[model samples]
Target: MSATGAAPRRFRHGLVVGKFYPPHAGHHALVEAAAARCAAVTVVVAPSRRESIPLDLRLAWLREVHAGTPWVRFVGRHDDHPVDYADPAVWDLHCAVFADALGGESVDAVFSSEAYGGELARRFGAVAVDVDPQRRAVPVSGTAVRADPAAHWRWLSAPVRAWLVRRVVVVGAESTGTTTMARALAERFRTAWVPEYGRELTARKLATLRRSRPDATVFDVTWDRDDFVEVVREQQAAEDAAARVSGPLLCCDTDARATALWEERYLGSSSAEVRAAARRPALYLLTDHEGVPFADDGLRDGEHLRAWMTGRFRVELAASGVPVVELRGTHEERLATAAAAVEDLLAAGWAFTEPLLPAH
Candidate 1:
């Protein structure tokens, strides 16, 4: 079926070939168009070793986008095939590669958007069905997407978008509403949220410590470096797992950067593991300590130390070299600022522009 909804000459088998480095809407249109016209469609993903994403991942993205479309089959192998798209003289070599890749299957039509589609179709003894040869249907390409995915994010399939989803971590001192804001952001974007794991671990440790000594309080038991280290690891695991299940964005309440700061506050020193985990996120939404009244949950250190820890987060975030945007004002105002930052991230393809200081 063509994009116009008219039945093009039906073929027993149709072929669509591309590196599909990161399959965008143009590729999807080509596949859908081909699938509409052919009894069975085979899409090829040929990735070179230099491709940033592995070949298997590209295949997975294609599989996910074309899910439930039984006629759309994909072909990829773990072989270092030659990528000579520059010279037409190498066309025969590529034809042989394609023939071998397709197992010399009988093909009736070739669907593509490139000028070389005619030649590729001729090699297969099939007619070329060029869909959006001028790229008018979807004015985006893999090169443009790779250069700035967030800019062309709408041109991408949800599966591909999910793969490129950026993590925006909301980190701040106690009573800063990091949790509330993270949840709100996730809901706003209709994506997943990773809750602060460190809080849970800290609560569990405090409970155990308090139960062991009924007279002593939570803050009396000094959390060691290992405790913070475990928190960082577990936090990362939870974030990663949530990201897998998330859509185009994953909102994290807090990450290892906070763990590092807390480690410094409690243990007097942060470990290499904690510091490493505190590295750059897509962006950081830091809730400012000012204006917001400190609420002492059983877990909070107190109102006085809120500023101190907030200062420490700034120091660690700067030292860790991550992009940060501090949010102030009421909860709604902070949420708006954070949402705008996330929108900007989505527009910029999550590219990092600012320089970061080296970890000391």
Candidate 2:
């Protein structure tokens, strides 16, 4: 304990470096443990040659995971890449860059399992403590997160776990089959989904509210448009709040644009009120895989009408501003594509219920 004299008093800073591609369970534990012991722990989300994950997203995951924590700070890139370690001294240069960031602030401890990490800590006058490389005590590591994200979600921060529950809302025209597609996505991703709330409500209220046909009685289909519009507006707002709060991502059956289309097509004009509500979902998905058999919702016209309705549906959704995923192909093909698309979306960060929960 005697360097100059009894190892001096413990420093307050703790420097922890990591890639944090997705900030899995193990990383959270490491961070939590470090934050507990250090006065301030600066997390450097290390840069990658393969930027499969962008710096901003990596930071976002860290921020989302550790949203409430006050001691954490993120720094991703360290000097330039590759470090030209052929020179051997390049490590010192790279290490200097990191130390400069610390600027006169010396860490009481440096935590890492990498071989060079201990030496690096010594250079900075740190107490170089090794976190279990085998993940025996704290199972947090960038590699583990990349390998099995879902299985080890409990290793992540509680806030990160909570942020994952959302239903991906899928929107499409009547008979374009959003219900089936949404269900398919849920099955494919093995998660809970929120069906088109408006459609379900509309299906029940079709008889009570009295909707006008698009081509009937001189093509004036606006009768009671406000009623349907209002109903959809309410349901959308509810689903949105739920999605943002506790989401596995809602698989929406239709967007407000669908209702807007119905109003414009059948009611002769669109509702400005409903259109405003359309901006809720972070993203809007529209199914364009046409020619699927129509279910004849009692309000539907005779054969070959679904294609026309779907076209009108697209025209309306295109204007809603939420990024769209237009699905196309035969019904089965479309469903498969939709499922794959959902998988991709989930990979890209779709919320789902029953996802991995964080451990204490």
Highest TM-score against the true fold, candidate: 1
Best by the lDDT measure: 1
Instruction: Count backbone overlaps in model 2.
Output: 27
Please state the error at residue 142 of candidate 1 in Å. 5.5
Per residue, candidate 2 scores C-alpha lDDT tens digits across 186-276 of 6766655556555455444554444544334312222476665776766666555545443344566666666676666556777778666
Question: After best superposition, candidate 2 residue 152: deviation in angstroms?
Answer: 5.5
Backbone clashes, each candidate: 3, 27
Reference-based lDDT, each prediction: 0.79, 0.61
Off by over 4 Å in 1: 1-16, 24-44, 47-90, 96-159, 210-216, 220-222, 349-360
TM-scores of all predicted structures: 0.66, 0.60
For candidate 1, what is the lDDT? Answer: 0.79
Q: How close is candidate 2 to the true structure, as a TM-score?
A: 0.60
